[model samples]
Target: MLDARREDLGRMLRAWRMARDPGLLPGPVPFRGHRSYLTQLDMALLLGVSERWYRALERGEDRTYAREMIAGVVRILDLSPRQATALYRGTGHQPPRHRAGGARPDAALLDLLHQQRRVSWICDQAWDVVAANTVAARHCPWLMHPETNTMTWAFSAEARYQLREWDTKWAVPLLGQLRLAWQRWPDNERLDEVVRTVRREPGVAELWEDTTGVRGDADDAARPMYFPLVAPDPLDVRVATYGRFGDTALRWVVLSPVDPSVVFP
Candidate 1:
């Protein structure tokens, strides 16, 4: 079993290295020592480890590296959330805890966000805004705030002032989604704090108390909501959610405008 796991990890590491874009490499030098794509030497330099050590791991000759080393490799490779978790498990190590401070969108998700013309953002289990595209930030400036959080922003006075039909269109559905997140990550302290903070609002506590299931699945249809920041007109948008493969706590949210004519400044 151990040998099989090591071989599998080695295969995955090779695949990731081969698939990596040379442009993603840091610094002006794209490749290390005249190699195309990411070479073992480049990964070693990036991780501050010796080439032999990195090569050993890639060859499945050694599977005794520390967790921190594995983490460094994850960062250097720009591994997806799922890939990071898999790396931990395949190496006989427990996966790291999901927390606000450690939440980050992987390279693929970041690339997708940059390519999207529609409003899109990524959030963690705590609903903390980890990343957003230009369109999302431009249309919804609040999403770019340093302390942006979906639950807090939804219940804030600013949101109430900015959104039309805040109660039916935004607040209710948000509460349901928060309830789902809380259920999935009940022990996450940041989420606990978020729930406590939101429960202090006028009717939000009651709504949260009544919310029992997840209502924000990928298939959940979008509802109409007016953004005063854009204009007085209502923009119909669909909110689609996607879960990262191994990291169920991270979500990708895309707000696709129903009308193709709508464009953000």
Candidate 2:
């Protein structure tokens, strides 16, 4: 039974690797002379493990594998939540809870965001912007940037200028949300990077350490917030968030105009 499971895992990993688009993966595009699929060496390097060890695992020779290594594989391969859970169980490690999150968003969620009449965006548990609708892109152009992350944006000098109530309302509550996510996904490297980046900002480190159990009330109260647009107009928008269906760790954030008469630019 153990051998069978290992073989199954090996096959599945190979299939996933083959199916992945090279352009979407990190590192150089022509990875090790293979444009379509990743070699064992490439996978090993990405996962920070030895090529021989990775090959051994693929051959079902390494029965004892670390959970962190498995997690790294999941991240590097961009595996779905379901696939990650299955890999964990097949390798004799207890799978993490369904909502263990990451940067990737589901296709259905992206489609929904695009179809929404109101401005909507999707983010991962780490608060990385995954997708945004046309209205959101038009109003908040920064959201369309390739490197935008919620925590990074909040602590930025640009945010200090654009966001109303940067210190009290924006930064404080955002830090609280980060804290809550940190508690839930302690080992998430992306979240770790966000925390590190936020701490470097002036006065943010103190707030992060001193503030305990701060959670965002946007979803609970459906409160409206003000966002300053580049066009010298401030929009009052109510925020609503939804979790992705199933065990995925993706969330959808929708912004509706508080005043019906106000039209988005």
Candidate 3:
């Protein structure tokens, strides 16, 4: 029983309002407030409408408003074109166009991956494997190791054994991270294709459907690894992940030695 218009408006308000910094917005600045101009009274004055009427519109009690009025409010709020359009659409007014973030992978990002000696890999908003060093490629070979990076391999076949841990503990956190990426890049075509391919794996599909968040319960037990090490295994490793923000994002995960004494897998 959520009102779509109210929800959309709330989302937009939250999104826009959170971006404002007190240092950036003018005024004597209340000690804690972020300085948003969209107070209920201000909204009423801007709309040239009664405070009660405006309150009703904000509370989802009113379903319609004048196009010009909505546009004026949109301008007063200083919304981006897309944000304004979303507001207009939510209010049953004609929206100009739909636009979403269009960020891409960067080749320069490989430098960041290469600098680290630990097991490392990079994935975009869709969890597309953009880059991976030799260490990550060696151990977690099932999904990311192949010529074509596929998420399906994580849940199927030998991965249950390959992960160095029992049960879905290893796979679940990875899937959760990928799920976060999917939420951000819902329209990525490659991601859609990857999701379709992963669905064929029953285990992956089940985990994907389960909404519970993944926690690293097995983190302590399952050490960072590279399967079948050479004779002089030099280090004890632990898995740690890092993220880099792009115009969109790319999750750059690096698995490193918790202590030097621990040997390679």
Candidate 4:
């Protein structure tokens, strides 16, 4: 049964790694076009570990795989947050279900959460906000504060606190990313519900019809905009966001200030 599970996991990793294109990685695109296949050695190099060590990993040997090492493999394979979490479990370190208090967030992740000090949250592979700090609660106010999903917050009026710029140019690409997520995970019921909710919310319906594509790049005209704090005067909270996707399904997002002066003390 154990070997069978290992083989199954190995197969999953292989499939996810194969599906990605060269454009997804850093450095210039390889010459002679590009190849889809990746050897165990290639994966090892991508993870910055020894070939022998990774070989053992592929064979399903337990042998102390560091969280970062496993995380690196997850990123290389481009696993969704859910997939990454599953893969993490398949390693045999994590439990299948939570204990009474539930699993604790890793120390590094917790540190990252506290550092942002803004309205930030982490989205699991299933597109659910698995973890969110108080700032996110204040800004988003889960109690009927417009749209629930991050995309909705980017496009809806309740999202007004997040959007300083008032143009479709800014809203369209973000919408497109959400659209891509819809295409990527049709089975994600939460995302499906979010789509339905946003679709009915006043102005969002119009933007959904005319989405261009995901546009968070530096060159995009929809640059960073500051959402003013209704409570305080002269404090413009300019949010700068960052994202890191694992080879597995998880994606971590950090929202912070464009400048130190904009942060709310």
Candidate 5:
């Protein structure tokens, strides 16, 4: 906390409290204080903290506070993202992400995807295809499928037809990355389901158990792709992956067009 800005934090908190209209809220509610603004006692009870602790936080006093207590205030106050971030900073802590908020496709990330002229899409930590731009949807049809788990698609027979040397080029590297992700976030339900789903595919269970192709991400090497399809596909594509959105740990997969000399499927 900036010592000079202590009173600044207090003033902001009081102002925010006054600005909040309790009448607009739904569900069983606590009685409002004078002039219908929430009181320190009401805030304390809503935040599940002691009245003394709540008073200290309101005044931005020099006492330590738990992250949950601060997060509770954010939830109860219904702070905007900017306000939540400022509150966390004022308390000398980085803002906590709403875990479920990261689950939905981020609009800013979707904007980033469409900004690319090349084929591009974004996936969350579990490799669930959250958003793919028009080019990506057109070029990599699998991305737009209702079942857009990359692991499931990579292990399926469709991948064999789409990718040249599927086992060595695509499956190996992809499985390695999925395995590493599962190891890092073993409890992630969607990722676990992806693991189970891919294993159900023929020979994939054996592949999952092997120690080979233990890569963290895709390499820049040009790989052949083919689409015997309903529409025209991009010519000579190379895979490039970028990790953006450190908070959500979202990955951007770009298919950059290369010279025609790239290997044919």
Candidate 6:
């Protein structure tokens, strides 16, 4: 099975190499009168590795791989973000994080939040509330704060009281997301701080460590919630998260009532 994976990656790499634009190749083009597609020798020279080593990777031989080796391949080939991610994952390594949460959402994107009458907010890759509609603000007061991180707030002591089935239903899935995010953006200080803060809280560390609990998102079931407005009654909501094609930093988190008859302020 492992051998099959390696062969598949080798073939994929060859295909991407074939598809590369000839004009993008760095250094002088190889001497056999270049038409299209860089030779393995060209790739080896540019990657600063021996021709034999590069061949092993391309031929799916059992050879040790280095992070920088793959990084060099990415640069030399000018791989797209998606392509780069595929390469890293293929090599059984975590891809370096991109600047997904760095840019502020443009006016048009922010307008989306303002236009929504539902309990909706926009969060960055770090899960910081970039913008929130009035309806969302009423339910999550922390969103009004300029620097509020939704992830941090959600993992806080107070969240236990508001989020129903806080452990299995909510925390488990969310922790999975947190783990993946941090793995991608290992250098993100804010995300690092959030992990630390949550780990320090009693029992949270245990939850974070439960590998079985890691999930991609926290919306598989209705998130039973409680708030002053819904006092004595649970405000069940279905969560949905959205992201644009090229915008990695922008995520739209919306909550719709489980019962269509329910409406938000």
Assess candidate 3 and give its TM-score to the true structure.
0.46
lDDT of 4 by residue, 1-265 (tens): 3487877876777677667553343111123355766667776666667889987777766577887777566544545657878788888656223211112234466457645566666555433344455466555544112113365555567555445554544566566666776677787666676678667777777777766544434222424444344333323333344444434344455555445555543
- What's the lDDT for residue 208 in model 2? 76
How big is the RMSD of model 1?
10.8
lDDT of model 2 at residue 185? 81
Q: List the lowest-lDDT window of 10 residues for candidate 5.
A: 23-32
Better of 1 and 2 by lDDT: 1
The TM-score that candidate 6 achieves is 0.59
Candidates 2 and 3 compared: the better one by TM-score is 2
CA lDDT of each prediction against the hidden true structure: 0.72, 0.69, 0.54, 0.55, 0.67, 0.72
Q: Can you list the residue pairs that collide in candidate 6?
A: 100-249
Count clashes in each candidate, considering only residues at least 3 apart in sequence or on different chains.
0, 0, 2, 12, 0, 1
User: Which ten residues in a row are the worst by lDDT in model 3?
Assistant: 21-30
Residue 218's lDDT in candidate 5:
61
- The full ranking of all candidates by lDDT, starting with the best, is 6, 1, 2, 5, 4, 3
TM-score of each: 0.59, 0.57, 0.46, 0.46, 0.54, 0.59
Candidate 1 per-residue lDDT, tens place, 191-247, comes to: 988888898988887776666553745345556766656657777777888877787
lDDT of 5 by residue, 75-124 (tens): 44557778878888888888854332234334455566666766677777
lDDT tens digits, residue span 1-265, model 3: 5587686676655556445432332111224454643465655664567777766656555456777667555534446677777777777888743323323334455556655565677655555454565455455543233123435555556555445442344566666655666666777766666667766765666766774576433334344333565333323455565555434555665666666554334
How large is the C-alpha RMSD of every model relative to the true structure? 10.8, 10.6, 18.2, 14.7, 15.7, 17.4
- Give the higher-lDDT candidate: 2 or 3: 2
Q: Which portions of model 1 miss their true places by more than 4 Å?
A: 1-101, 210-219, 228-231
Alpha carbon lDDT of residue 67, candidate 6? 84
Candidate 6 shows a clash count of 1
Q: Which scores higher on lDDT, 1 or 4?
A: 1
